[model samples]
Target chain A: MSAALPPFPKPQEALDAPELLQVGSGAEVDEPCLRADAARNRARLLDAAGRLAAEHGAAALTMEGVAAAASVGKGTVFRRFGDRTGLLAALLDHSERKFQAAILSGPPPLGPGAPPVERLRAFGCALLRRSIDELDLLLAGEPSAERRHTFPPRRFLRSHVALLLREAVPDADTELLSHTLMAYLDAALLHHLTEQCGLPPERVRAGWLDLVARVTRTDPPA
Target chain B: MSAALPPFPKPQEALDAPELLQVGSGAEVDEPCLRADAARNRARLLDAAGRLAAEHGAAALTMEGVAAAASVGKGTVFRRFGDRTGLLAALLDHSERKFQAAILSGPPPLGPGAPPVERLRAFGCALLRRSIDELDLLLAGEPSAERRHTFPPRRFLRSHVALLLREAVPDADTELLSHTLMAYLDAALLHHLTEQCGLPPERVRAGWLDLVARVTRTDPPA
Candidate 1:
């Protein structure tokens, strides 16, 4: 069975920022006088979380370890992040924000304003590259325990890709086609490419570009 | 980590003959020919096994239940199928052979003989159909713990698609591209369509056809 989406009570909170922390916290934290030391502590905690996730698995990450690494008290870490899963969710949000930026505005190919088809190819290629780069982070975000009914980044990514496909193909079922494309671009496929098939990154990107071009081209099926 | 494939082994004698029984003098008697009673017993055993598997799932199937359902001794069930795993394997084999035929020689589009693109489209449609019709059987055969190094059916299926792609896009790295396409058709994707996304079977098929046709059309990258 497919894993259920994460069940955040207010799903919109996860979808939109400025309200992200409000799902559980009830109100937005709009305090303007945040101390410099508080921001430093927050940065240190997030940094420690990333290092731990990269060095060990997400499952291995512990609040105690994070607190020790950040040189913060255990109570402060818990007060800031709640629990392990909560911390993991925050980590996912942090990574997704960075990934979203790359896709939306980072540079040529992956960024906006390029031809729809080329940009789509770049998106797939860049996603594969990022998957390879942040495997542990991606793996950690996987839905387990069947608790929530939230949208996955992959879902949003697929939807965005589908929007691009509408421009490329213009005639196909955009949503379903997007799902099909995302299915292929899954972490499993990326893992198989680099880990199982031993294909190099440039070669994988080239192959992806060819597939996108072939599929999105105006030529009728032979 | 990916599931390990099982090593292939020779078929056991118990599954080879369904109607044979040991006589008092250790002679193997063709029970279906000599004892009408023995033939009925064999049929009963198979029916019971099927029911149990359908009811409790393939994993939950037990020889003990088969014996009770068939009104046969525990030893007789073991004598017929060797063990629960063997029985499950045999059941899976029966269905797999039929599926292989459908893809390999059963019809146009899906079978060998159609134009490569049509064949590829048919292949995906057939696979997605099978994923819905035989989810359990498909799940059982994968990540099999035999022929461990062999690519999955999806991989092989994609390889076949890649061959077609090579014909259309000779310079592209179609091999890896095929892997990506196969992943798109994975059971998980099918589950998402039918179970999670709540789309009908035809919708998924149409999407696949459109995807394959569009992706493989002979167009240069934009």
Candidate 2:
């Protein structure tokens, strides 16, 4: 807890953090400013890096492995990402874009075509899956405790929950309710329950459904 | 994070940690071995320390201040608790015991006589008040995230909430539900909301009531 740099910067100041689907804002990325072929190369490297992370955990992702996976030179990997920290940040931003896109417009439950309660359930499950798949990546990427709630990705996720909660429970305090709901899905708690306490994915998912029902005043799905 | 010690130790390892009220089993503590006058003296010192924590916050609760407040020598204060860390640990244990005692037997809503849901609401409000009052002390004493869920003081508090949740929502998953409820009153979260976000204490207290109602599927108090 010294001057050690956090893997990611504050959301508003995270110049490189992908702008996660800010409603009404189109294409909020830093616009890499690469030529078409170079941009395609960058995407390829990130995609390969992501696969390595998902398959072997983020801790296993190395610049050389990324270069080998993408069939690029190790120097190219270093030049592209600066170091392991840079690669991880880009990896999170890469996955966050996909996640943001899915929640914004990709499908039914998590996107626009489902009930608020259903959306809430889908959102948590999706996040849980991602957290599990990218456990080390996320735990490493986590901001300091003081900045955790205000981090951009976190803000985006919390707002999404609040929106659905407001729709699902107009009579309740949805803002606070959203915080309560999001707390269940926190990275630290998830790590404790799943990895430390050895709860399987199904139990965690079931808990999420039960929680959504309790907060939304709905029956759990049959 | 390095091996550099946090201001506090793990609860179980905290040699001087006050024994919390263990349900069904009764009081579990390292009983102070003292004669009547010595025990009274120890209590007086602890009481003075608690007053200092409550009045000026725990950061200001120095051995010198406690000695002056309790009309004892500084050497007596240090000898009684070993050092600053020892004194703080003892102070927290002292507070934890009082808090546990209140919930177990003190009176209506916060204690055993009232309904579980009522007790749950009162528990959060009371905890939020104490967390706000002892924000610095609790924040410094927070266990590392990995051990947070299993920390003895935290486990004691969570179990108490779980017991109430069992009675209030027998149909639900009380274990996970207790975690949800506890998360809302977490010392770090409370500090962020009150000290960082500037939410008034009344708002936080109201939010707690709303959360209890939502999780319990009851109407908020009008």
Candidate 3:
């Protein structure tokens, strides 16, 4: 049965993007249109809300809490983000942009300097940490099954993993492998492992490293 | 960072079930209470419904279509399965039982008497084919992300994979690896890969074999 299947494509050709990858974090695509100080104020509110969510939980993140945390009027927050749902979406978008920046251009390992395998390791670890911090918010924003793969942030992240896999294991099916790797870092899976199954985050992180090693056929970093 | 993490438990300990694995296919647990004739009649209705779904797709499946197909009254179909939702769920349940039987005791490679690695490969291939045939129905019945990992049918399936991985790779974290393997065979991922991405089912099947070989550190069968 396997012998009858078509030959696998070269990793580079198979994983090549036909169009430019959509790197824009959703909701932040409109950032430049805001007046400079308005953008700053929005950033400030999101930052305050992010801290509150991180310190307490996403359920604790209210428009009023964000207003008080940022020392802006509650009306300012309402005007900026409409309501609690809008505020949560903006908070997620804010964190996603920061995460993307770290991977796209921050320091080594997670950024550009490290080797592909090492970068892959750092990427999952960072994502695991970020997901743990924002599991509730991430779960709340999960796209429907139909849209799950097509969602822009998810596509961008998966594309990043695919790109790294192409560099790390150029002879393999990195396109599919990337999805498998990304599945390990999925927010819902993280929630189940941590909150439901009661596995420690460190154990899950170690599993990620082990998975990256196995998938790429590389030795774990010493 | 990895050293600070606690050691992974032996595969046996980690994968051990505290309770007997719930082998019951949901909706079928109530089977014994019905009179034998009523049960036979229900099976006949489900069989008709399943054939209609397979031939014309799940959306084309209706109470009237099932009744006509089975040469029974529409009221009988309605009474047996309640409505279209009930009918669809029963159709899926019927297929799940057949699939479980195949894996549990039906034949070699897929059933018994095959090497663990071979069984794992055949298990995925069988699932991929089943998923393709029932893609529409599976996507429609997808559990919410919170419940996805906990859904009884899903847990039963995942436990099977985890058990196989334990045999195939005793030193690895088979519990975590099982989730990684199961994610590949996920209905949503299958839908996205085949329908949305236009990959043929054979390509997806080949990918599954490749994944099994990589995760188990074995060569694909010659």
Candidate 4:
């Protein structure tokens, strides 16, 4: 599958360029201006909160829980995030940044060192995993219908898929196709399939690969 | 394209059956118990409201406009539907029933008596057209993310698509693929593509046909 496709037109430079990889919506907490130590403290707090969310669900996440989990004072957690809503937003923003970094520079398949098809497959799987892990947080943060597609994080991710699809299926309607591809990985749909319908994660993962192969007109990796 | 595929297996009976075509969510205005003339009056009022919504966006739809358009007293409109919210719900219910009737027994292609793949193509085009016409109403009525896939009207439409996909590509994951196909016709997505991105309706329609073709692995009709 890898050799059958042309190399992704210009994987590294095109993907690595900061302009192409900006996922921040500007509404998230400004990180660049935070002093180094404060930024470290925030990151550590978010890490603890992320673990709490993954283990106990986002609805169960609390500042006090994160504080105790991170061995920080409750006041410290409060001083950092302000309220539960702020904590939730910061947690999502933190995860989004980490996921964006992984796509831009982390490693092969998911990052930029593999065939576009492989990367596309890897991307969906990784996103599905993340969605499953933070379903509550994602659902709670879902934008209104009018704003859902226009949301910056969504636009950024959709653009990334469009870029990959352009490389894999040059003749396709990549913009529309990217939306279809992203729809398959939608948080709402994932919740319905996994939580409501009881579809196993493996089945959903397999469906993603199958869908990518069908859209790209390639055989699924055996 | 129609002749290339097998005839839709038991199209008329399968699709015509009331059980297979039920679209009501039980929350919409109940119509069965209304007196005959009263039902006709309600339908007439809804017809006027539908036109009002389609011509001047759903936001502009009002009891006064509908009463004037239907040549009925304002109190009649208010009495039939309790308020603007009730009017909106009834308008949507009226359209849903009409659309359901079309798929159940109305005509070839969209109804039955056509190959499954052709029906699938026709289904998407018809849906996109309807969605374009009632974009606001649909978006306003969009269920929350948690309830989205489980909503009865949505579930019925998805089941319809899944049934078509079953006949068209028996080996594929029709459940997941049906969701993908329906996602293309989502009101929010349509709003984004046409209203936000400024794509023409014909292009969005073309994308639907292309998506159906790709998903079914069939050649698009010339």
lDDT values for all models: 0.59, 0.77, 0.82, 0.82
Best by TM-score: 3
TM-score of each: 0.67, 0.79, 0.92, 0.89
Stronger candidate by DockQ (3 vs 4)? 3
lDDT of 3 by residue, B1-222 (tens): 562336665543454452233533355667879999989888888888878888888878889999998888899987777788888888888888788888888889899899999999999999999999998888878878888888767777888888899899998888889999999999888888888777778888878888888898887777
After aligning candidate 2 to the native by TM-score, how far in Å is the CA of A10 from where it should be?
24
Tens-digit per-residue lDDT, B1-222, candidate 1: 111212212231112121211111121234336467665666677667767776766666788988888887999988766777666655554444455676667878677677777677767776776567655544554542112123333434555676676665564555655666676676655655566656667666666665665566532112
- Alpha carbon lDDT of residue A35, candidate 2? 78
Please tell me how candidate 4 rates in CAPRI terms: acceptable
If the candidates were sorted by their DockQ against the true structure, best first, what order would they fall in?
A: 3, 4, 2, 1
- RMSD to truth, every model: 10.9, 9.9, 2.8, 6.8
Q: What interface RMSD does candidate 3 have? A: 3.0
Tell me the TM-score of model 3: 0.92
- How far does residue B3 in candidate 4 sit from its true spot (Å)? 31
Question: For each of the candidates, what fraction of the native contacts does it recover?
Answer: 0.28, 0.37, 0.43, 0.44
DockQ-derived CAPRI band for the predicted complex in model 1:
incorrect
Q: What's the residue-level lDDT of B179 in candidate 3? A: 92
lDDT pick, better of 1 and 2: 2
